[model samples]
Target chain A: MSFAQPRYDGTSLALGQQSDEELMLAYAAGDLQAFCQLYEQHKNPLWRFFVRRGMATECAEELVQEVWQRVITSAPGYQPSARFTTWLYQIARNLLADQHRKAHRRFTLVSDESEALESMASQDYPDTITEQGRLALRLKHCLGKLPALQLDVFLLKEEAGLTMEQVATIMGAGLDACKSRWRYAVANLSKCIGMGAPADD
Target chain B: MTEEEKRLSALYQSLDKENSPEHVDARILAMAKQGALVHTVPLDVKQPSRWTAWRWPLSSVVSAALLVGILFFTTSPLLPPEEQAVSASSYDMVPSAPKQARREYQAMPEQKRQLAQSIEREAAAARSKTASVLPAAQISERLAEVDRLVASGELQQAGTLLMSLVEEAPEAKARLSEGQLALLQEALHRRSTNQ
Candidate 1:
């Protein structure tokens, strides 16, 4: 059976809402229930990360499975030096890299013409619209138009709620470089969405 | 600060407000159960033997017999006709000669040499194509340009140049290969290390 089937209940969700590191520690200590909770917490976001990055729905599903497989395989050896989300994102990033490399190698002839970023942009917009939807739509479009690195920095910072420091660590970039990319991403996104430069936080 | 900038920030904050989806919990639990089962079954299968003293040696004998049976089945085709005839005279010896021939084939120098040569040829062809497509001089020049920009403390310009170089080069689209795309990575690495 596909591992994509959901396995938790309302009570489990309530219990599983604990921080990732806590859940992971429990899982490492032989608490299968904790691992289930951790998986429940991350599956959708991880799925969306791949989905929004231009992976086909089937590929995204497979990637989600692979990500969890990695977690399962590595759990006994997992060290909680950072937040569990950080570790999870690190895995997601590696998987994304490998996927991109494989795709590049497979479609070497059509590499330039794939319009991956454009495809990703098209996939990110929601179907339904509300009163406040215009801005969200614009933001999604702007995010799609960003350079891949800048887009990743923006997504990790804003969507994932990672600190610039954590983003720098994840991206293997200097803090200043991360900050600079964030600034550029924000500025470019603003310009694309007909907004000016970002205000100082 | 412009009103537009404030609005954009507010918009971004709004986007970030969407909570993680509800179904993630269920998926996690399923995955955990699957993981537990994968890890638990092998131990369970081995548990009975550990509990019984006689069963352990009996299990070992059975395992060796099974191994020999498998070796005999897989290797019989490799035995010479004379060896096969001699092995056929006795049931136990029938399995042994074929297993020996298979083991010998596996360790044979000629087979290994042929495999190594094929792999080497494939690698050489791959290297040649990769080398031919990538103009080494052009890459070096771009690297030099990035170095010049960084040396002048034009960090933003260096970044832009690096980005442009990566865009222009098919190989550097991925972030992991930033070294091949630009010299900025080294400078950035040095700066971070200094910090």
Candidate 2:
């Protein structure tokens, strides 16, 4: 069960066009290009996954680095029973869980009106870009208030581009439970951003 | 889900596109490179190969030591019976040549007096012992002296000289000329007549 073994000569396929699983296997075998490509594919999503969970940029950066490090460290033992993204997100989720355990809080809320306005006020806002940025900032403030489980599912959905099934698998819950979390997160966030509460099912 | 819900999700997606720091990428890549090298290497192979590497030289040294041991054991019995009978000397792997020489001198006199008396008493014994030992030149000189004594009519001296010559080496008996023998016989007869 190698996460990153010296090199996997399991398949001779071209790395650039390979599947995520194939790239992971190749990277486990010490194929540098495969790792780079996998990194490129997942870096933004992983970073955003942490940031959207209300982690500071510094904290998110450390977590992101840790997730990738775990991937490298565990490469030798990587198995293909589940999807590579499933395994990758599981590591990130576990790290986030650990952070939560240490802090005794899911995340810090945008508690102060002044700080939210201050954070949003410092950055430039011009035209539609400014408007979108403002709304996004406002939504980010509201996201901080969502329940931890819902917020996690929502972030995994949009940030990691995982399917409902994948999110459920990572969260270690039933598919219906994942759906419930996503709906609650969306509704709460929508109301906070001045959209009306979601319609009843 | 409603279009608004979809809009909200899409807007959340666009909310942030943060990237990982450069150091993170560099660190992970470095670790991966190290791991790849480790995968190819066999860690425990060195000690056994080190022992194997010395095998040829070690075997040669062992073989040389065995040969020397066999040679020593085989030649150890060469010590004479008296030396062999001694318990302490039995442990000597190499009986020294100079020790045997010393032992021979202890039994033999420092000078030639005893050797001369022994030869005089038993001419035939000395003859056989010295046959392969003394050089030919010394024997020739002794024969010439005997001839001189016979020429000068010193019959007693000539006869005494003959006895010494034969004692030194009995083979010198054949060195005397017929005239010299006849002169010695005449001298002996004259002595008997005088008596």
Per-residue lDDT of model 1, residues B135-173, tens digit only: 656756776777787788886677666756654664644
Native interface contact recovery, all models: 0.31, 0.56
Native contacts retained by candidate 1:
0.31
Superposition error at B181 for model 2 (Å)? 99
Each model's lDDT comes to 0.62, 0.71
TM-score of chain A of 1: 0.73
lDDT (Cα, tens digit) per residue for candidate 2, span B1-195:
788778897788776566777787787677667766654455467555776989999999999999999999988777677545442332341255377754664556746534644454477565567774535688788678877876787767877666666666766667667865665565557667889
Best by lDDT: 2
What DockQ class does candidate 2 belong to?
A: acceptable
Clashes of each: 8, 15
- Segments in model 2 whose C-alpha atoms lie over 4 Å from true places: A1-11, A106-131, A198-201, B42-195
| True lDDT of residue B112, candidate 1 | 75
- Write candidate 2's Cα lDDT for A1-201 as tens digits: 233322346666777667787887776666767878888898878877788767788798788878887887777667777778888999999998999899887443323232443444344546666767777877887666566787788888888888899999999999998998788677666666656553222
